[model samples]
Target: RPAKKELIRSGIVRTAGRILSSAASTPAAAEKTMALLEKLSTCTEGRAAIGEDGECVREMVRRLMKCSGAATAHGISALWSVCCLARDAGAQAAAEEANGLTKVLLVMQSDCSEYTRRMCVELVKILRVKSTTSNLSPYHSRTTHITPY
Candidate 1:
């Protein structure tokens, strides 16, 4: 008799993607999604999976701009994970295209938690390093100036 093959269900990344897709309109749902994102940030495969979804990355950046407290901190952690894991130019380009740099800067100046502010600072440094290495300007071409918080 042939050995039975194990069935695989949707992975954490897939579930997180679904949660993030619906999180925009609901605050409770956003909180849950951010928690998942924070957990995902601890693993390289999870980070890569999140980065592969352009919509997810855009939504995370949007959350960074709008969400407060733990949600904002989770968004920063998730973005940091993506930046650390993403070796491709497309990932960096997608982040820049989504106006992530300016949003992150804004978060830095906001009265968010100290952890959130530190994460934003780290994210800004990562983006600057990536931009310099890629030979692109630190700010995206479309982002002329970042408004003060």
Candidate 2:
């Protein structure tokens, strides 16, 4: 964990993000980079670094499906980190704009853990809610559930 922080301190996350978009980077390399990014996302500086790097967010969404199974999981976990854990609205919007919802749903149907699936569901719901609330109808405003207490 400390190693990850030190790497973040060294500003390597941007280089890692660049690797994600480079054609010369192999699948194994990409996976390793993603795993590192996923681990780094646990820290505030890491999440901030990811959010600050426009390529990091866009390339993550761009390479969502092209990577291997573990890479996909790590990528999704990284996305969940910045978008959900850090509550980054811009990242959420970028994911939504890139049609990451379909990708998230597809990954949810795969062999990932329930926690990851829950993250996928939350990402979908959060983006959906944000998109809908912009032009909310009366029914959307009213609570579907009612209680007398």
Candidate 3:
């Protein structure tokens, strides 16, 4: 049997390709695949679900955003779905670091598409809401809207 890292890497690659292709081929299937990808976007081996090579994930998301059809909505929604999972696994640090996750969210906020902007705002809210605590509440409240994304 291969190491878990190998298995995960394979899955990541497979999912990335599926997400890209699904952007055009099948919105329903794409949504489902995106869900799985989001699930995989959890902490693993002291790293993030999206892993160090987030370029692939980011690119896929960028491509999805580039789409101007119904598919784009599904893809953006799918990305949002994963942000919750990522927040859960990686915690505040995940949101703060984790390979430009915040940057992507900010970019989505400014997306020409209204749906994408709404989705990005929602994702930021989710991260802030989920991670807020007595000690961090003030910090989050003050910086939530001003962070890079």
Candidate number achieving the greatest lDDT relative to the actual structure: 2
Instruction: For model 3, name the residue pairs that clash.
Output: 42-49
Q: Which digits, one per residue and each the tens of the lDDT, describe model 2 over residues 1-149?
A: 78877888898888987998899999899999888888889898898888777678777877766788888888888998998889887777777666676778788888887877888877766666655333321234335467886
**Local accuracy of candidate 1 as per-residue lDDT tens digits, 33-134:** 877776765655566666777667777777765655677778877787777545535555666667777878888887778877777766776666555444
Clashes of each: 0, 0, 1
RMSD of each predicted structure: 7.6, 5.1, 9.3
Q: Best candidate per TM-score, number?
A: 2
> TM-scores of the models, in the given order?
0.69, 0.79, 0.38
Clashing pairs for predicted structure model 2, backbone only: none
Off by over 4 Å in 2: 130-149
Q: Candidate 1: lDDT of 136?
A: 43
Please list the C-alpha lDDT of all candidates, in the order they appear.
Answer: 0.66, 0.79, 0.49
For candidate 2, the per-residue lDDT at 120 reads 83
If ranked by TM-score, best first, what sequence of candidates would result? 2, 1, 3
